[model samples]
Target: MAHPTTSVLCTELGFEWPDGTTVLDGFHLAVGPGRTGLIGLNGSGKSTLLRLMAGELTPTSGTVRIGGELGYLPQGVTFDTARQVDEALGIRAAREALHAIEAGDTDERHFTAVGDDWDVEERARAVLDRLGLERLGLDRTTGELSGGEAVLLHLAALLLRRPDVLLLDEPTNNLDRRARSLLYEAVASWPGVLVVVSHDRELLQHVDQIADLRDGAVTWYGGNFAEYERTVAAQQETAERLVRAAEGDVQRQKRDLAEARVKLDRSASYGKKRAVTRNDPKVFSGKLKRQAQETAGRVRGMHTERLTEAKERLTAAEDAVRDDAEIRIDLPRTAVPAGRTVLHLDHVRLPYGPRADLELRGAERVALVGRNGSGKTTLLRAVAGELTPVEGEISTPVPLRYLPQRLDLLDDTLSVVGNVKRYAPAVGDNAVRARLARFQFRGGRADQLAGTLSGGERFRAALAALLLADPPPQLLMLDEPTNNLDLASVRQLTQALAGYQGALIVASHDLPFLRGLGITRWLELDGTLREVDPM
Candidate 1:
């Protein structure tokens, strides 16, 4: 079914939190039918804009107009564990009504409840199957599903409604490769106004347009994520060139201004000497002094005005060149010597999933891949000593650190620096703050409570705490490390990891993120653990 060329419009939209924190001020955007990728740094209100468009939130001022029915999926979706798959699909009542009608119920209410959805259950099943949820029947409870499966289920529910305007927020954040491919197919074929907020580059490849939200404004581009990158790169290069030119002009103006001042000073000195040498009329002497002062003032004002204008131009040019910088820090003590065994798992059996025997050598990067519920996280926790193995003998030759998916490694009551300092009790406040600065939490930001920070900031804080711990981890274990990171934060993580010379084992579904780390080993966990080719 093809939808109308309906569009979503925001008429000078303005939004703010309850506590008077402004997010968007006089923002305006229009999204037409077909895929539009919404991208921005974390805390830049991309999610908020989607919420507003879906009517999940009302703008503080201005208007949001959608031309058709809408469906929305949030970044973190929550479902009741007791709810069955049918309930989660939002068709339990309708299904029950249809069954009653077939059982010869003469009540008009049952027919009313069933409405036009006579084949609702079949349609639900088909959509579920399309989204790779056929393995789990509709009678199964929500708790029986994995995180990625649940996300797909949410999307499936939205699709079942056949909304004309679909809004998905971070839809591919935790999906595996296959799940992402399915989602991409759905997005590519969607006929309605589809706006997706995501940092997943591959997913963004299916978009027809890219809308970038930054500093409370939207900039539209005419193509997919790759085209947006190329266009932005070209613009940035031009902006940087203009910045350099403006800087040179400013410097030249300053030099000219200084020369003008010198000439004015020399002229004043000469005028004074001439007046002393010539015993002319007092009026003539006064006129000559006035003229000299006027001429000097004119020259000084002209140069000063030119210099100010040049400086302003330089400032504007610099502003056009985005100043977003990635995190760069060194952790040399984390280096491990070649051939040193950093970890050894002798016939380890997971409590719920796989069994394996493994030996991890110095500075080896490993990618742990599998479907959801395959126990990648359990294996990591066991290796980190956070969980007791059902049957295993594990040895760690060096200090280790574990970063879980939830990133609950920090105390919410404490500040970021406090969290790092707690992990490294021997480290002083100054040292901790210095390290936090490298993580991009400079000055007062280091003192913000962990509970108050945004998703990206909290992840950086968690990473900083883990890496800055005492003795320095030579073995770092991360579970779904890139789960909710925006593109900038992901790049920051990559930059920071590039400097850490440690053995890393990261369980993540993001193939690009894994490849970015330059994985030397690939291990897939099922009921059995086995090594797979990295390629």
Candidate 2:
């Protein structure tokens, strides 16, 4: 039996995909009441662990125990569009039962169904209001709500359950500034055990501690994301210093071994000369020679052992240092000269978003931010020519490319190399592969199918295709590009964008990423597009 206070406990937990890919082996985790930020790289099994904890998946080998009722909000909050918001909130039955009794049905079943949840509807409504979804009435169909609204609705349903344990995966992926703020408030006040797997720094700021899932294990860090960063930075600095010291030790060992060998050879030569000059008897001379040979062999063995130990230490030291690869590519063709007209929007009105006029010239980098359901994605689609504007003139003097939030640019059947080739048909296979290597899709990785890729790998492939397109995008637009990406991958993306010389527009809620882009302009979409201070 698990401890009474332990909200969740997994003992000797292990899981493997049907295809024989092992995710976790002998993994043991115990989480108590409080918010824990579960962080890791995209393919590091954070979602898998959450699924196991939520009972959505059965482990191949061990047991999971929960001390209380559990609620889970998946990364993708999917439901039938025809379902009512009340049904989606898991309160339809109780609400119906209460209404029937109010209407004098006089059925014992209604009373039984209502139980102690007579105020279920009110509680649900309050949760919705807290999550900024009060406008979304219970009578509304799920289809009427946007993606962000669906996510919040799912969270509201979970909150209504009021479980002792709550697990949320990428909860803030599609949320905008205001929605995220609302979520932050909810997380702050969560009394039960909460484990959230996310890359959103703001959301992570509310965590009581960070559980970094790396290399199939959990390493706990006290405090929130900022403190975790500081701790890891300090650790890396120490690891690097150890690596340097170990390297020096290895070099010294090598030199000492070489010198020992030279001295042994010289000593043997001198012994041979001395024996020949002394003209000792054959038996005595041969015995002395054998002894000298044995001594030399022992000396050589000792030096070799010392060298091997030094090399082993060096290897361990190097392993301690993080070698996360970065994307570094030079695209001279993507550059847009100063005063060049990249994009122009003449009184453009988005379908459900904003009505605005804008002109982007030269290599200006723009950050587009807004509240959820404010139509940031809609405006990007309109600019990308995916959607017809309500009424306006939009012109692009140079070639452009848009990376949507869904990342549907690549054909699932094609490999990463093939996808890039499809975009840049004129480029040779070898040339494409060479460029993709810079994006960390090296060798066999470049040959993997797009459908088989993890979220981060797929993002990288899509980004590579867009940037390496035939004409090279002079006006590049991205919608929530950092979603599903790990912190390291986010840094890699930031580095890649740093090398871009074209006019760039990114619609994202990631303040740190936007700030890192050296954004020359900041625009907010409400009812209209307006300039905001560079944040």
Please name the candidate that would achieve the greatest lDDT relative to the true structure: 2
- Model 1 TM-score, 2 decimals: 0.94
- For each candidate in turn, the TM-score is 0.94, 0.95
lDDT, residue 402, candidate 2: 97
* Number of clashes recorded per candidate: 0, 0
lDDT of each: 0.88, 0.90
Residues 51-75, model 1: lDDT tens digits: 8988888999999888878899887
**Clash pairs for candidate 2:** none
